[model samples]
Target: MARLVRAALRSNEYGFALETPRAIVVDEGYERYGVTAEIASVIADGAFYYLDAPVKRMGAMNVPVPFSPPLEDMTVPTATSVVEVAKALCGRL
Candidate 1:
């Protein structure tokens, strides 16, 4: 993911996409387990200047998975959600 960040920064892209099974919220006082937060920190520490826009993250909702298949499906991010996030990141929505 760092490599991808570097590449996107080197290029003229607006931003990059990050997909994870777990949600990563910033400044929620739970840094120990936030992969997105850790990655954001790395970018801020090492490649802040290269960012043309904020990093975009797409992952599961911040809730335990439901036992029911339908509810479980709703808790996780889908490809459509990711695309929507990417669109928003690019100012397309």
Candidate 2:
């Protein structure tokens, strides 16, 4: 992992961006917004040629997660979902 990051750092012509390939980004916020969105945008603009498929992000739903367990379960990404997404990305599912 460190090696990959180091190589990414070196290949980053933009100075701050870390280019990666077939990256799976997961967060606690909206998948299409915030930090995930920023990374996705950067990859799309810079390292897209390295990707075999479009980037996929897993995160909480559009609605705010509540304190209630039931509501949070519906809003947040589950471990199963993450695994499924990863499998789908790798063409395993």
Candidate 3:
């Protein structure tokens, strides 16, 4: 539907529609490999009409996880980052 605001898929998809003009799919996988990437790719490849804007994918930074506590925190996606991305996708950022 046109009014579909947002959707997030983690493990499995059960009759979910990827035809929202402004939907944001957040990938919460912290590791290098996650199933969400596959789901996002599948949705993005076939549902172009529903994707008015490019889907935003957020995950761990493209670097090795740091050992220091503070650095580790910076390497992974934080609550603020999620909120910011969500707001951006919703055109509120």
Candidate 4:
């Protein structure tokens, strides 16, 4: 996702006002247990690729992390939300 955003920033077609040093604020949706490391890797890549501003991460509370089937779906943001966050990041640029 961060890579997609970076690519967008590099191109003027994405409606980005700035190029780099952009901030990325994520929601609790991306904080899945199995994919936490992968998500962190994406964050790290963002930082390495001129993500100078703060890479804010807003995730759910660090309890059991919620795995109760149906309950889990509502506990985090959907894919649309994540894209919205990326769009917001682009807007900030």
Candidate 5:
């Protein structure tokens, strides 16, 4: 997802991937996934915002993060989901 977002930013020359004002708003996913401090800092300074309609990212269903590959496949989002989130953020959805 980061790759795709970066690609879009590169292609459009948008300020979506730079770290300036430091206002990163991830999809509320980091906490659940145990994202690192470095990653959080980068996202905060670089990305600054998310692209999901949920505003707060997806909610925790109280279910564990899947370990099985197939379960993970069902639980985690796909590239298409990321794209849709981006589109929604861009107001193109």
Candidate 6:
């Protein structure tokens, strides 16, 4: 994932991928804790046309992380989530 981000930042013709386990709500926390939106903005402003596909972001559910183990597990992004998002980005979904 780090490799993908680094490549995206350096190349205008690559797609960006983000996978996180925290809820990225629409608030100050989004910017303070997550770089998904900021990365998108940079891509849009600097390399919109260079993109071959849309940005792919897979994050936790839009809620606070639960204290319980089971609930916490349900809140975060899973392997399936990553696979699905990747497929969608590749136009296979």
lDDT of all predictions, in order shown?
A: 0.53, 0.69, 0.58, 0.53, 0.46, 0.53
Candidate 5 residue lDDT tens string, 1-93 = 556545544564436444232222334244344433334444443444542222223322336777797775656556666667656665687
Tell me model 3's lDDT, rounded to 2 decimals. 0.58
3 against 6, candidate with superior lDDT: 3
In angstroms, the error of model 5 at 30 is: 5.6
Q: What residue pairs clash in candidate 3, if any at all?
A: none
| 2 or 6, greater by TM-score | 2
Report the C-alpha lDDT of model 2 over 1-93, residue by residue, as the tens digit. 434544563476534323434667688888765667666666666666667778777778887668899888788788888898888887897
Estimate the lDDT of model 5: 0.46
The per-prediction CA RMSD against the true structure, in angstroms, equals: 8.1, 6.3, 7.3, 7.3, 8.3, 8.0
Candidate 5 has a TM-score of 0.41
* Model 5: ten consecutive residues of lowest lDDT: 51-60
lDDT of 3 by residue, 1-93 (tens): 211211433232422344345545555455335544555566666555656576566676768778898987787677888788878877886
TM-score of each: 0.57, 0.69, 0.61, 0.38, 0.41, 0.58
lDDT (tens digit, per residue) of candidate 1 on 46-66: 445655565555455677667
Better of 5 and 6 by lDDT: 6
Clashes of each: 0, 0, 0, 1, 3, 0
Return model 1's CA RMSD, one decimal: 8.1
Point out where model 4 deviates above 4 Å.
Answer: 1-49, 56-67
**Residue-level error in angstroms, candidate 1, position 55:** 1.5
- In candidate 4, the residue pairs with backbone N, CA or C atoms under 3 Å apart (3 or more residues apart, or in different chains) clash, namely 18-93
